[model samples]
Target: MAKSKVEYVCTECGDVSPKWAGQCAACKGWN
Candidate 1:
């Protein structure tokens, strides 16, 4: 089985992040 993981996805550019941030690294959108 695959390990469970938590991530944050960018709503604008469909970017995935392992941790939460104020801005998206992919689209530079405010989260």
Candidate 2:
């Protein structure tokens, strides 16, 4: 079976992340 990973997106810059973060790496927006 394949494992599923969680993804997070930044509202300001539309950045996609593999894990949850306090801020967005691309736009530096708070999540």
For the record, the alpha-carbon RMSD of candidate 2 to the native fold, in angstroms, is: 1.1
Residue 27 displacement (Å), model 1: 1.1
Which pairs of residues collide in model 2?
A: none
User: Tens digit of lDDT per residue, candidate 2, span 1-31?
Assistant: 8998889989888899998888999988998
* Candidate 2 TM-score, C-alpha based: 0.71
* lDDT of candidate model 2 versus the reference: 0.90
For each candidate in the order shown, give its overall lDDT on alpha carbons.
0.90, 0.90
Residue pairs with colliding backbones in model 1 are none
Per-residue lDDT tens digits of candidate 1, residues 1-31? 9999999888888899999897998889998
**Which structure among the candidates has the greatest TM-score?**
2
Name the 10 consecutive residues with the lowest summed lDDT in model 2: 4-13
TM-score of each: 0.70, 0.71
Residue runs of model 2 more than 4 Å from their true location after superposition? none
